[model samples]
Target: MIKVTDALNRFLFENTPVRGNAVNLSNTFQLALNKQNLPLGLKRALGELMAASALLTATLKMNGSLVLQIQGKGILKLLVVECNSEFGVRATAKYKGEIRDDQTLFDLIEHGQFVITLDPKDGGQTYQGIVPIEGNSISAILENYMLRSEQIDTKIWLSCDGNSAAGMLLQKLPETMNQSTKTDDAIVHDLDAWNRIGHLADTITDEEMLNLPIETLLHRLFHEEDVRLFEASNTKFFCSCTRNSVANMLRMLGNEEISSILEEQGKIDVNCDFCNTHYSFDKIDAAQLMVSDVAAQSSKEIH
Candidate 1:
């Protein structure tokens, strides 16, 4: 039975230096795609990315958010998904021209770039990694990035069927020195174990990934090996956009820009691409923003 829904399950191979995560997004996936009018193929792609983002976020030890983006120069211009430490996920996509149902990843995104950014919730320096798009699917591209850029041997399998999105990730942990010494024999053993478990995981079919319960799936894959499954972490669709955030963004545009926009459009209208939430600012709101900014500046100067 598929007991896990909109949750991530972490597991470890007790005897080997390998760890893995599995994520299945149901209502969360549907809610994320509800606001967008994406093509079928692009919708599936975005769903896969959303699942992948959650899986990647689970691997991080930081207290912030992880953003995965694929920007292309072809029909599919941009695909972005963000997952926070709490497993809150949001996704958006932009595409120009027609995207056919039969088009594959390479066919839609022709000269693309994959970028990953880590934004800490607390005041800290953000880190980002950029690489040219590699591989044909989102799973393959991310696996390539994990191996080449992050220098971690990673394997990812992603599946999205418009309604639900699911993914599984297996990673080989770095060798640790036990008993004050590291030897070639230990390294060789770790390598052999890693390869063996990876091969077992490779046989999982997409149907199983999307349909099987976490316990059943893991047992089927690693029943022969000693594995320990951790408690599942809940995942949900969440958008962090608010009217105040939109106001702050407008404040950044300065008085002149805000005035110009207000004049041309009568009122400044901003719609969040992720959730399709609308925030409108009229002349009064714009004036209040400038007034608040001036008052804050005056207070700072006086101190």
Candidate 2:
């Protein structure tokens, strides 16, 4: 089994109109590191992205997926993670040269744009927001993006070492308490609840985030507040690439290009970047795939 202890929890102030989320990632970080031979710096960066992606996904009210990508011309060329509403996760990173031994975010990806793409699986158009890299930490950059692009008051705290990565998010949901609600009513009735909630999140330490279970961590953070915790969701390292997916790409390339590859390289070899799994098709296998492709095309025409 893929042992990923990443959990996402949605919480409400039970009596208040404010809502929040806290996400944890530990083994998930190790799983991503285990898949590729990444440098210490890149590994740390990837872990931050993993945790950030999870936190971002957990806040989605719509049934869709979010993809977090950072692209630049510096050492850390690319970092990407896709998280669906179901909490399924996968990631990939590309970089060149020695990731400075004691590198920070700026040291690695000099100038980049952090992008979040929302893909609704129910056949709707995807939306993307691009934000310039504004801060040294991934959390800061994301917080800035949320405020500047989405115009929502948001605060994020993310921390990661070589062994594990973790984060917390406090967002202002769209809701208003009934007019009868008053500050003298209860602890949750105050508008300052969002700031106070963020203060609690700030007290969370990296060790707690990396080791403690979600239940323990949440209780520790907001013990005094009336928190409504949702069922924890599971996250894992999953890649959607397969030999058949590669074959579909070959069909898209058309027969001439496919034949040219066979004539030159003897066989077509494809490797999935997400998992580093390789798929090779010999000339006969390639020809059979082509025949099936033509039949599918003919059937579509007949229909």
Candidate 3:
């Protein structure tokens, strides 16, 4: 029997300009999907996005979060997934109309836009990129974006079956040539190695990706190549929503808006889309928010 883990593994080829990451999201995927009442196709798409988000976040060298979003005008309205530098991930989807089991990616999202955002945790500036949706699969869409926008040669393989989501990413880094010691033959050799390894990774099957362990999969693909795999990093589902965050949002709405809602519905109920957690603010709670704000402002003025 093979042991499976929800972890991301990074590997590099010796003396080659190729690097890759493999992720298996068994437990994390299920956890993310626990409260979602999504259709089969949409659920699978969200899972793939979760896996891809993890793979992309692992490739970056930043202490921030990476968000992947797809918005469409068809039955599927939105699909969003976020992954931070620490390998934490969460995903959610919004859709209208009936979703058939046989729906394809294009069928679900007709006029879609793909958006990527990089948000730093330390109050740094955020960067965002948008591109018209292309291709039918998430892998093809992201591969196109990486090659066209970032100028990096990338290949991604993603698979999800509602139970498990897994993915592998292979990237060919830019070759750095030492003008003094580099030879034309060395550059040629590097290109050849990249092509060889990329083709080997392409031969991976969905079964192998979702079932095989990272070590077995790597060895199976690059048995003849010198591969160095780093320590495994755990991946899990995490939601950043909290009662304080909700309170802040309510405070922004002001006393008049909150009081109106309190009168009509007796309480304001907010549900987190990612985790489906419910937060309620009653009349007393609403009044207390304004009182606290006034106190804080008065204290600041006195100081």
Alpha carbon lDDT of each predicted model: 0.88, 0.78, 0.89
lDDT of 2 by residue, 1-303 (tens): 232267777667665556666666666666656768877777777788888888888877768889999888888889998877877677788888777668776777777988999999898899999989998788888999999998888888777787777777877765553222334366345668777888888888888777777667778888998777777777776677888898998899988899999999999999777777899999999999889888999999999
lDDT per residue, candidate 1, 98-169, as tens digits? Answer: 878888767978889999999999978999999999888888899999999889889999998888999999
Error of 2 at 5 (Å): 2.9
Per-residue lDDT value at 243 in model 2: 88
- Which ten contiguous residues of candidate 1 have the minimum total lDDT? 175-184
Candidate 3 lDDT (Cα, whole model)?
0.89
lDDT of 3 at 233: 94
How many Å off is the CA of 36 in candidate 3?
A: 1.0
Clashes within 3 Å, all models in order: 0, 0, 0
- List TM-scores for all candidates, in order: 0.92, 0.86, 0.91
Candidate 2 ranges beyond 4 A from true positions: 1-4, 176-189, 254-256, 288-303
Q: What is the lDDT of residue 135 in candidate 1?
A: 81
lDDT of 3 by residue, 1-303 (tens): 474679999888776777889999988999988898989898899989999999999988789999999999998999999999998899999988998999976798888999999999989999999999988899999999999899998999999998999999988876552221345465547658878998898899999999998889998999998788889999999989999999998888877888788889998999999999999988788889889877877899999
Tell me the deviation in Å of residue 31 in model 1: 0.8
